[model samples]
Target: MAAWFLYREGHLFPCYFYQTTGFYCLGCGGSRAVLALMHGNFTDALRYNAFVILLLPFLAYFLLSMLIETICGRRILRRPKLPGWAWICFALVAAAFTILRNLPFMPRL
Candidate 1:
């Protein structure tokens, strides 16, 4: 129900992270990012935080798939386990993305 929850209460949730830290972290702009995306403002969402913009669809699909499996398992193909190589690949990809995003060269990577 993550999508529904987000849809219903996009900005209603209080962020304990900011309240406790007194500084915005990597996930700080996520709510506004979601709001911007919902408002048909992809550019604004990316400007607010590219990570959030990039993560939403993946998260939505993941949640939906999980819900479908829990509710009606046979209709969908069984998800295969991710291999060790796959984990390594994902980690490398994430690290590369993080570094690129922070670097001065690739401003929009």
Candidate 2:
């Protein structure tokens, strides 16, 4: 669905966050990023959403691991144990990124 979000140059749905707050959210450029990635424009994709680029590897790994586990019908993919604090830290970082990405100086493209 994401890969084809922009197929055939159809209209894009407006982002309610930006419409209401007049500020860009961390996911403001996600559509553009996906489109760019589909077109094989790595640099453009990162320019559109650096956070997406940063998380791509982890997402791919997790997806792959899940697929393998599903295919084997067993617990073959074991995720490393993360301390509670690690999750908290991740939440904090995500919140910070959301705030920082909304700044006027940050490129919302």
For residues 27-102, could you state the per-residue lDDT of candidate 1 as single tens digits? 6667777877888898988986777788777677777778888899643734557899989987787666555555
Best-performing candidate as measured by TM-score: 2
In model 1, pairs of residues that clash are: none
The clash count of every prediction, one per candidate, is 0, 0
Q: How much lDDT does each candidate structure score?
A: 0.69, 0.77
RMSD, model 2, all Cα superposed?
2.5
| Candidate 2 lDDT by residue in tens digits, 1-109 | 6446585453257789989988777777777776777778989988887787778788888888889988998768776778999999988987888888877887756
RMSD of each: 4.5, 2.5
Candidate 1: lDDT of 83?
90
Q: Whole-model lDDT for model 1 versus the true structure? A: 0.69
The candidate maximizing lDDT is: 2
